[model samples]
Target chain A: MAFLTADDIALLNEPQLAHVATIEADGTPHVTPVWVDTDGEHVIFNTAKGRVKHRNLERNPVVAISVSDRANDYRTLWIKGTVEMTTEGADEHIDRMAKKYLDKDTYPFRKPGEERVIVKVTPTQRLSQG
Target chain B: MAFLTADDIALLNEPQLAHVATIEADGTPHVTPVWVDTDGEHVIFNTAKGRVKHRNLERNPVVAISVSDRANDYRTLWIKGTVEMTTEGADEHIDRMAKKYLDKDTYPFRKPGEERVIVKVTPTQRLSQG
Candidate 1:
């Protein structure tokens, strides 16, 4: 199984923001900041099913995610991975991520009538800088 | 012409970091944080030729760039566009970006024997959140 190193996992464990990239149906790429998590072996983020990223990944699971330490400009990790799993606990996942990132107990921006989807990625390659 | 709003131009004009996403030759997406700049109308960054991203853009110019407000996660701009220009002057461009991001007049990470490539993007679609 793909795994982050002890040091790298520690880096990712912080509340730093992450950017997830996915390809559009027409081949254009789309990027957005995400609240990231890990299940020991896979990276994770939560979004709605019909969002651009979810739609893109449904058609093509390949992705590259970059996590940055905002306090230190030179520190970062890049994960080139595929969506090995799309699970259904986005509501709870977003809450967990919200606690980590926003210090809030619940995801602050969740809207009414919105559905949630969880994306889990398995890294095929990784890179780092500091 | 595609353009940013007054509020967004101010957000992006800050020294915050950006993540650029490009499509691979095989359809996989690649992403990395970059020191970003603007020509008031175009987005710019300096990279080296033959790098995975440069090669990818050469093969497929479409790209997605996301700039975040490090101090505030909710403020950002997403620019989806093609590489409108690949120009020279990367040395100077990198130095300029270094000033903005690192507070140094010259880029400190320059390596010997490496060529610099300047890539400029014209946003065809833009999105923002605050």
Candidate 2:
């Protein structure tokens, strides 16, 4: 497994959006933006249980994420990884993500009856450019 | 096939970077940032021969692209498409992309012995959010 570099950790600590790609049942790709974080070992993001990405990852764990420096597009972190998802601590995780991305004490867009899931991606391949 | 909306076209016209995902032979995803464009009917981008993206697209046309407004991360476009690659006009195309992205008359990163390829993606699905 590939390990996150100091630069990668620094980028993840910034308030930047990450574009995540997952494979559909038909072998096509699905991608969307998400608030991103890193535990210094795995890349983490939060999603609702019924989201397209959650469904896709449930079937196929393989995923790719691209995060670029908002100020410098050339500085980017591209990670190909497999995800381990859980509901454990997902509520607090989203609140932490909200603090980073929205500067809110809690996620402002939480839907009623929605079940939050935290996805931890263990990088198998990591590439960066600047 | 899905068509680009005026908003999608406008987003493409901006100097935003796009994260493109292609499937590797191992069924894993590879993603990176690229200079993005559109020809009204298709999403377009440029790359050189022997690049991982070029090789991946040559093997599997299925692709996904995500482009978020630099100023507002919430404004984003996510597209799943099939690519049609060509060497024809690729040189001129990169120059145009250079003009849009780098404000240069020509692509300044051209390398000796590198063959540029133009990739046009016919979107099968387009999703947007703000």
Candidate 3:
């Protein structure tokens, strides 16, 4: 698998929203807007286990995410990757993302019966534009 | 396939950037930012035949697109659909979309030795949020 460059990490660090697409078992697609993060390599997002995106990822790890610069829509990053999902520390991960995205100390949208999972995607290819 | 509502058309009519994801023959995803349009039912975008996105759509039409309101990032629309690609009138369609997104009289990005295609996506399901 390929890896993201420093420039790609810079784009991911921005406050722009990212859209992720996961293919279904039947080859259809399920896409959603997500708060995206990265550790300068792996792109990450957290979602509940019951969410459709989580279910799709469980069946097929292949995923793609695209995000444009909030200030300049022409500057964008597109990542093609496979995911590794883990439940450990998912709550903490969401809290960190909430702080980055919503200025909240904790994720305020948690449901009573939901279980969060953190998906870490290792890039196989990255398309970065200015 | 499902039909888009008037509200959905309104969203597509806005001058927001849209990202489309198409699954490659090997199931890896290819995502790109596009200028989007609609005829109150089908979402549309134009791409050159040599573009990676157009190649992916040719073999597997199942695609997902997400676009957020440029003015307010929270408002978004995610559409899952199958595409109908045609070359007829594609040049004109690109001019229209260029005018909307770039305020250009014609598509300023067309290249030599390229053939443009118009992709009309009929939504199978849509996820809209404000």
Candidate 4:
């Protein structure tokens, strides 16, 4: 039975850092923590173009995301989504999205050798249980 | 084309904390970082009885676990498995399992209000991509 309701989706729309899981060509899962912003309709996050996550998404876009309260047993939101990548000057967009998860003024805006990419995910499924 | 072979599993079996994903009643996924020992044949971890993760398992046994190198783009391991809970003086077993993930000399051994449960998961599927 489906457990998530529209209200639950709204509840999860807030800004937060979520753990993103990606499937590798070998069927093994690759996971990493990322800063994200939910627009109620989609998930947005950013990373470098040469990263494993970027490579995995290009190979296959299926992914699962989990967002939980840092403290134990408070609340959690899980999102099953597809990867959407853009190539035109995406670094600026990615940097902006990343800043939301950090202290704006002090966050490392970018590192010299690091190239960034912007990714938007449209969730195909969502699960939340508290 | 499996990304992980027996050797990779063996490499991951060494004591480590993995992020475990559980399905919540609301269909939202709950994820928590946990101390785990991979037995090659099975994955074992522990948690308190009334915890959300424990409760989630009682409702549904399906789970996915992700183990990754803290450093960027190194390696990742994913295990899809079912839950196995044991009730007998499981606290002792849990304490022992948890200790393996920590420095024995200074780990928090026990707390009065806490109740521990032992969980054994035999992975049905694994995915690793770096």
Whose lDDT is greatest here?
A: 2
Report the C-alpha lDDT of model 3 over B1-130, residue by residue, as the tens digit: 4487666788899878888888777776667788899988889988888578887888888788888886676677888888999999999999998899889999888888778899999888765421
CA displacement after TM-score superposition, residue A85 of candidate 4 (Å): 8.9
Judged by DockQ cut-offs, the docking class of candidate 1 is medium
- The DockQ ranking, best first, is 1, 2, 3, 4
Between candidates 2 and 4, name the one with more favorable lDDT. 2
Q: Candidate 3 chain B — worst ten consecutive residues by lDDT sum?
A: B121-130
Reference-based lDDT, residue A129, model 1: 27
What TM-score does candidate 2 reach? 0.95
lDDT of 1 by residue, B65-96 (tens): 89889889878888888795455788888888
Task: Output the number of the DockQ-best candidate.
Answer: 1
Q: Write down the worst ten-residue block by lDDT for model 4 chain A.
A: A67-76
* Candidate 4 residue-pair clash tally: 8
TM-score of the second chain in candidate 3: 0.92
Report every candidate's CA lDDT: 0.81, 0.87, 0.82, 0.64
Clashing pairs in 2: none
True lDDT of residue A74, candidate 3 = 70
lDDT of 2 by residue, B14-93 (tens): 99989888887888777888999987889999998889899989999988899989999877778888999999999999
Off by over 4 Å in 1: A85-87, A127-130, B127-130
**Model 2 regions lying over 4 Å from their true place:** A128-130, B128-130
Q: Is the docking of candidate 4 incorrect, acceptable, medium or high quality?
A: incorrect
